[model samples]
Target chain A: MIRGWLSSRTDLPLKGDAASRFLPWVVAVMVYLAVLALAGALLARDSVLRWSRSLTGTLTVQIAVPAGERNLDVAMADRIDRTLELLRRTPGIDRAQALSADQISALLEPWLGGGAIVDELPLPALIDVALVPGARVDLKALAERLAAAVPGAALDDHGKWLKDLIRLALAAQAAAGLILLLVTGCAVAAVVFAVRTSLAIHRDVVEILHLVGARDRYIASQFQRHALALSLKGGLSGWLLALITLGGAAWALLSLDAALMPRPSLAWLEWLLILLPPFAATGIAVLTARLAVHNVLGRMI
Target chain B: MSYAGGPEIVSDLTFQLAAGSFHFLTGPSGAGKSSLLKILYLALRPSRGIVELFGRDVRTLGRADLPALRRRIGVVFQDFRLIPHLSALDNVALPLRIAGAKEAQVREHVSELLRWVGLGEQMNALPATLSGGQQQRISIARAVIGRPALLLADEPTGNVDDAIAVRLLYLFEELNKMGTTVLIASHNESLVQRFPHARLHLEGGRLERRTA
Candidate 1:
């Protein structure tokens, strides 16, 4: 009832004068940056989880024949077969397959162009292994067994590369989080400046309301409502712009050759996560305005 | 209260206003009539005195309790501080809105009060467009429309002509008859002489009460 009366009774929305007209746009930019940061965080999280899932409990065995060695063909075949047999016999090994020559050629086609000279080089024979989920195979023991089974055989779990990938993903996520915090701080500062300008401009109105027995909370709520509305406007705009940017980037990435990089696809849940930053921005703006109004009014009476 | 390292604005002041009484606070310029009203309206606290309102010591009341007491009091300023953006009707309805009155109730009461104040035709006019007398009347309407227990007006008739001033006085009288204690502060000797209410005369921050 009171809200309806207040809305119908007055049309005093707090808008900045010409001097402060850029406040909403500033808020919009802040929200945009914040959304981007959040999106980056989400993307990093998604990429890390996907990479971890694909790499966990998986091993790649590289059987490299000595460079320029005589009769490399027979040596490579024996090593590859021995590695595969050893991997297949393992207790936790789900599947072990030696990749065909064509598959290996395709894998290197992007970096090393297909030609007679490239085909002459002695590339290592690669065996892909999948382990059963939660199956604990002692990798050191397996490596020792592989060494005994075949000379010049190595079990490469890709641990070093996986660790670096995870660290990079985590670092990107942390950086995104830091950006979000800084954006929120900037938003708070903007809100405080706007609220202070409003208070200064409407000082007489505040005094009249105070004399008429309006509580501090009541006056503060008016400011909070004003700020919330502005922030919501800015936040929605920023979110839409972010979505457009993300969509455009995804489309651009789709136009590139698939072999160049991993596909940039987001799950539906991950897309929904993009909505969080704008909402958080609006909440921060409202809280900042309320606190600013309350603190300033506290000094008055 | 005293200023920072300055002489006291009001001191040794001890007085109580009975319910349903009216008074005219008259004093020379800078004699602190407005200052006393400020203290009465809970705007200022005296440095060394206990103040009570509606039989409650104001010093003992918590901050949360002030709004209730303030709602019971209506104050009209000397400058007629009307919100320039709001219409006269909206200005008059401010207190009612703050009190959470329904929209229909607020509209009805505000319209009726504006009509009574001869502002029915100008209800939708902004304060910037209104004349000094019209603004003063609007301020008075806003202060009294909530039917507060006490109505305090500072120089209520300072800007109006003699005829309108008399009508405004009659409006204050009508509100007083309805059980609102009224206090009007003015230095106009002729106007103060016309009213037969008690006079609260101030000199050098000291108060002297004289009943009619």
Candidate 2:
């Protein structure tokens, strides 16, 4: 069966010669796409996790006061500190800290101008909070309690925007995965079509085999073996090219964020998974060649 | 074994071309002589009655059971059905290969056979490069290479010159002497008349024994 599967890509059936099915340009495109697939998978696995870790379970609370009451600041500040103390004592609340003048000033530097450009900078007071994993927070209850303690207090949960970001990332990963599957499917289909066409072109060969007492399996083996070889070659070339491209891109990304580059390593388990491309190619080849040979033979004789 | 086809090409075809038996299947064109030989060679199943060969009922033969019997019988098609891409030698070796004969065994047998058919030096040449007579001779070599127990030829001499035609008949004579049943189909009444063999003559899909 293996030999039979290998023989299918061939146009020169009677000559006992196998031809390379991988045209160089098509191989290049395959490599390019393979790289994209690998990179997309890697990003979805490791980099996405890193991005989420940096952003998840954290919130920035923006406390704003009406414009006219600037002098009630001292008492309001005291009440704000007390309310933060209450929040730190709440269950599942890991850590909470109000932003000081300097940090808030730095946060506004990008948009509100830097280095004391305005004598009186009217800015909202902000608090940062971290939540324990799998923990729930009643944001509205916290907001009501803070309001009772310091009428000027407000809580900013940051959940909605973070959820939207994570969803978008997941959607992008799914789209990339779907594209990979479609391409793999097309590659398999193309091999099948090519094999069937070659069989059709060489109808005389089939006739000769039939007359000379060759079984359908024997004839199919000759073609299928050819196809299986071609598929393996083409598939491997595509995957290797993809890996090189992904490695290069990953190197550039690591250079940009050296400390937070998500380990810059594929674990032994991950490496095993990464080795699947060539096998995938071989599988597609077998399926394509078998289908092509069997379909044509069944129909023709 | 009654197939759906109406008339038997060799109706009431009772005579066996026994071991070492030689016969000419002669009739006018479209007289079903070719069809009769097709049944004898296991290419077509006969419509009625038992067609036995090698001590097995051919009519009830399964598809899987047929190949072993078929390999024992050599057939020369009217079209000289050689693979277009294979060389003269490879085409001749095809049956041996199908029989699982090793490469060395197939090559030794095929080369000597091609040489016997006057294609010794032309073994590497493809069929398209050979003349009609040469291709016919190669087809003859392919059929007779394994020295099958039976040889069936359809218009074996149709495309050859009188000299080559005589040579081919002589080759059949050689195979027949080795205990192979030789059945030759032809319309050339003169050739049949010259080579006196038990004649199974066909006309309008009916068979009758005739002296040539």
Candidate 3:
């Protein structure tokens, strides 16, 4: 009984929607931008985390054979086998696999062009290494051992390159965050303007309500409800637009499959994050409308 | 009561009506009859006087407390301030809605009051479609819908015919007899003279009381 009475008590007429058509579209655009930025940030951060985790305990050993050797093929084969044997004997090294000539040529195909020149070039013999989880490898000591066994042998732990990659990803994520903040601010400003205009249009209604003993909260709640509805409408539209755009991009990326950039994919948790922008936009609209109404009512009798 | 840095609109106003009493406020233009009524209904805060309404000092009342106090009183503006977008029934149900009354009770009471004010057929009509007299009755029905403890009307019968005016006065008398204090500010002294109620005469922002 009480709930029914309270719910039916005060409902402002939804007529006289002076800015309804324009305000929701503006909010939709803002939310779209916000969702895109949030998605970008989430994807960038996730990619960085996955890349770091996969690359954390790995090394690549490269042994170069001199270009003008008397028997370069035999010398290269001997150095590659010796390096593999040494890596297998090492304590922290879990697995080591030496790259075949064809494999090396394939790796360079994208960069140096796939032709006979890639075979003729005296490219260094590459050995892929994997370290046991939680096992610390002394790369300097390992490098010395490999160098003693074979001249021109180099061990790369990839720590410096990994640091730079992670840094770049973090910077991109931060830029996306800044964009999200800007979009949220724009949404708030739009809501405030819409609310202020609505209040101005309904100024006489407010005065009559006040004269009839309506409390400030009662009056403000009407504006809040209206603003919330607009925000929800706009927010959902923007979210759907964002989802369509993302789906299209993912499809395009799948079709292109490792052509240039990395294939785009989002984890389940990351996909859930796409829902935040609309709800946040709605919340911002409600709060902004309430504050705006309270500010105007404060100045009135 | 006055605006800041301006001359007092109403001053030396020192009279109290007994509960359930009815009084007519008579004054010429610019005499501040409406101003006094505004203060009485808590619409305007007086600059340099204590206002006691319903046995509480309104001077020290907080903003949060104003709505509750206001719910106990009702005001009919000189201009019928019915919401133009709302129907007559909705306008009349406004106070009950504001008080958070049950919808069924609000509908029943507002419907009954609108009928009593001779607006049964026009209950669903917007204020803009109604004649000025109909709007005036709508405003009056809104004011008395909640059965307020005090009722204030400013030139309420200004737009109505003499017969309707008499009927409206009888309605006010009935509400007064039911224990609601009534104060009406008007320039219609002849019409007011037809009733046997006390009168508060204002001249140049000063007040004089004349009792029956």
Candidate 4:
């Protein structure tokens, strides 16, 4: 039954009209932009979530040496050791380990480059702290305790950085959502214009249909079917193009250092989400055409 | 009665077409034959008069109610208003398809009707490819294929020869005998005189009923 309905012949020569010829292309472009925007939102959200999850239950400690000191002196080394010991004894902290000189050098290699220059710079001692799962540590109290136990010691939970990252991700997703909404609006407007033009061009055929016992819905269905077919054609093409573009972008990003660039990856669910724009475009086109036809036909006697 | 605030093309016209009866609506070019037929088929509502169909006043009928009522009526226009894109078979199948008849039944019935109208081989031919008279026959075939309770034809035989015209009238009569009410509007007085059915002659927008 569905097949038959889809293949039903249209009484109006809608396919031959100029508007119908271009409608699919318009839909394709709209769906393409929509898919990109939606993908951007999904990727941003996913990346932020992964980053945040990795950051949870983890803290960092930084021990600053005196300004005039060129390296981690005995006094700074003692402060770093005391900070790590204090964190290890804290109720919520599971482990605390101080970073070696080589580890800190490796962490700075991407920005500071290699060699003695990074070694000669006045560097601070660092400790990586892990908290127990579901741990609620009073970070301010811990910082104060460490400061009292060892001067120039500070506890860093990375809260400010994570909060800023989350805010940026949310803003990106919101922009993508807004873009998707605008694309949808443009698609609907295109469909309405095309349908109205087709109606005007085929007024006589429509009148003939009406006189021969065809209802408004019957006539509107003809337009709807045409719009659906066109939109699907355009949407699929747009989606395919978007996938290729995304694939190309991912390929380009693959050469970048993984540590520098967040990998552009989509889970199975995200891929499925990317597939919705084409179907969504077709739905919008079909509905817009149907409503336009009905509105115009309603005014007819 | 009027169009776009212009003078009334047809006014004060009151007539009833009895079920199972056939009538000829005769008038000159400007006598509003087409306008009256348009009103009958629910294409145009009279500006200020009660128009009823199938025993219901058209004025009281909402837009949603018209299609069912329209399905019970069929119309053939003076211009042979066949859909240019559709084949003769598809064009004739339109009314049945619109009414949601099964495709198998629609094809069978529409094919038989096309054959009866002498266009069996032209079933797949588009309206643009058919001659004027052939298109007229297709138009007639489309209108009566549904076995509508009322059929309105405006100059249905205008493009055809006398023999085909007579044959088309016989088809309308056949439907009329089967309880279909038919109204054929034409300026062909000789053809009207040949028919035994009553006539509704329109002159200057007024109507005069003539008994058979």
Candidate 5:
């Protein structure tokens, strides 16, 4: 059965029409855009998940240095110690440790350059806090307690920063989704236009076939087969191009500092997900061709 | 029937072709011979009047029903209308393929029919490479390949010589002997006189029947 279907010829001479010659190229470009957009959306989703996983149960406490004080004064040191003590007493607190001045300097080395000026700068003392997993600490009450314990101290739950980052990631995802939608619409329109032009160019052939007792579906199948073959060719090329582009981008990202940027990586399943656009383009092409043929044939005898 | 608000090319005409009958549609140029053939082949609908084919009303048949009806009728167009890209064999095999015949059967049947039409050597030749008479034979082979119940030909012999036209009519006669009704529309008065079959003579959109 498969062999017979494969050997069946298209009676429409669809492949020779100048109108559909560029269909594969059009499909390739559309699939390429779709893949990139989908990849961007997937990457955004991964970044959001990774950031949330790492930052979920952590907090930071900053102790601001008093104005005109170029160094960590005794009073600020005492306040840092008090804040640490209070955090250790909290029920859900797992561990609290003040970052050493040298450690803060090392963290700033990337931007500030390793110089004696970093030592002279009045840097605030920072405390890194880890909470017990699934802890439900009240951030508002904790901030108030820290303020009372140390006049210049504040508890930083990182909620505002994480929220803004998540918002940005979500916006990127939404934009990618919109782009994918537009690409799909454009691909469909392109296929429709191509099919219509082909129909017009081969109007005589179609009429002959119709007179020979070919059903609308039989005639449409010819166009459908043509579109399917073209789309598959275009889809594969587009997918290969996208994979090359993604590989290049990932390789480029590897050169940047891991601490500075979240690495854009996809799991095996995500790579598989990225393969959908090509098949989707094929499906859209075939269905569009079939519908276009039927629509045009319906208008005829 | 009228065309897009133009004057009626064929009007107030009624005729029925009995099963297993043969006739020649004789008319001069602009006498609506092709228009009448178009109505019979279900390519055009009449602006007014009932057209019944194979026991079904053409007007009542839906778009989906047309194919089955058309499959029962085959048409030989005046222009030949051969697909320029397809080989003669493929073109002749079209009706059987459209009917969903298996490839082996399609090949076997098409090859035999092409041989009968004297196009056996030109099976692989494109329509553009063949002469007008050769194209006409290919068109006829395509029409009769599936053994349609009704065969409608518009100027099927206009391109062939007198001898070949007589031979083509004999081919049609052979098909008619096998229970297929045949209608050949031509302006060749001498050709029509050579055959004893009934003639459907059309003049200025009216039909006059002369029984054999």
Candidate 6:
């Protein structure tokens, strides 16, 4: 059975049918594009959420007391020293530091610009913490403790920015998934139609086989093998071409001025999603050919 | 061969040609002579007749079981039905190849038969390149290549001159003498008269035996 179907493919001029060849190319390209779109949603959104949440991983402390404000400056500095001491004793604290005046301004320089204002603009003291790698810090408990030691102290976890970023990333990924489904459906329909057209054109061959008493399976197997080969070839080639195009787009995105605009870095693990298109194409093509062949044979005989 | 269409083309036809027997079907055009020959060769079903060949009913045979029967009974159409794409040799070898006989064995048998039919010099020539007599000879070679149990020829000599037609009939007679049942359907009165054989006559889809 396998041999006869194979011989039919090689002996018959099925590839001579233009639709047979062209359809695979279309399926390959569409699937590749769909995969890249899906990958874009996965990698970009994941990176965005990760970067946004990384911005605030520490707590700060300060003291407010009655006296001349400059006299209380010593007390505030003393309170900051105690807070850092206490944070070091905490279980998950990797390291914590109270930022000096200049260190605080350097952090705001890109946003505020250089040497544009006189001294003494009121700014909250900031503490930078480098968490233990792969560790989770308790922000609520740390905030309460810092408020008690330094009455004016407050903890910043960068929650609002992270929440919005995660939401937007999730929404984009959802949209990409919807597009992939639509493209896959379209590819299946195209391949099915192509197979049907080729079968119709080769009606005489089918008639000859019919009169000669060839089983339906014997006829359908010929189309199945041909359709599968063309589809996979087109699919793999299209994926390579789509990746080349996508890599160029990624390069363009990366070349933007980082000081003016920040974008998520393209990561390796998430590109795994890029493979969906070719596999989808192979499945659709085989299914489409099988169904198309059976349908045509039914109508023809 | 039993067909169930509204009108009968061949009715109550019952006869058999023993192995090595040769028969001639003679009647005017449209007298169902071709129709009767068609049934004999498994081409058309008889409206109301039992055609038992090789101990099996033609009408009861499934399509899957028909090819071997067809291969055993070589059919030469009145128009010389040769596949135009194939060379004369290939056309003759089609039956052997389709039956999955050993390739080497088929080549030997086809080449020898093609030589016997005087197409040895026309081996490489396609059907379209052959003269009518040459093409008809190739058709005969194809029919007899398998050494079929039964051979059916319709107007086997109609398209050729007397000399070529005589040569073709001699080939049929040789095959018949070698143990192949032969049935030749011809409207040519002189040709049938020249080649002596048992005659089966049909008129208005009815058969009559002429003992003489």
Best-fitting candidate, scored by DockQ: 5
Model 6 C-alpha lDDT per residue in residues B116-136, reported as the tens digit of each score: 877888998988988988898
lDDT string, candidate 5, B29-120, tens digits: 99999999999999899998999999998889998999899899878989999989899999999888888899899999999989987898
Per-residue lDDT tens digits for candidate 4, residues B108-198, read 9999999999999999999999999999999999899999999999999899999999999889999999999999998887887888999
Weakest 10 consecutive residues of candidate 2 chain B by summed lDDT: B1-10
* lDDT for each candidate structure: 0.84, 0.74, 0.86, 0.88, 0.89, 0.73
Q: For residues B26-103, could you state the per-residue lDDT of candidate 3 as single tens digits?
A: 989889988888898887898987889999999888888889999989888889988888899999999999899998
Instruction: Compute the lDDT for candidate 4.
Output: 0.88
In candidate 6, which residue ranges exceed 4 Å CA deviation?
A1-21, A24-28, A31-188, A209-237, A257-291, A298-301, B1-97, B100-158, B161-202, B207-212
Please tell me the TM-score of chain B in candidate 3 relative to the true structure's chain B: 0.98
Report the TM-score measured on chain A for model 4: 0.95
* Distance from true location, Cα of B142 in model 2, Å: 1.7
Q: Against the hidden reference, what TM-scores do the models get?
A: 0.94, 0.78, 0.95, 0.94, 0.95, 0.66
Worst ten in a row by lDDT for model 4 chain B: B186-195
A43-79, model 5: which lDDT tens digit per residue?
Answer: 9889888988888899999998866655657778888
Clashing pairs in 1: none
Error of 4 at A118 (Å): 2.3
Task: Put down candidate 2 lDDT per residue, B41-104, tens digits, no spaces.
Answer: 7767776678889889986776667667878888999999888878998889888888778879
- Which residue pairs overlap in candidate 5's backbone? none
Report, in order, each candidate's fnat: 0.67, 0.36, 0.71, 0.81, 0.90, 0.07
Model 1 DockQ class = medium
The runs of at least 3 residues in candidate 4 whose Cα sits more than 4 Å from the true structure, single-residue gaps closed, are A1-5, A68-72
**Alpha-carbon shift of residue A84 in model 6 (angstroms):** 4.9
How many clashing residue pairs appear in each of the predictions shown?
0, 19, 0, 0, 0, 2
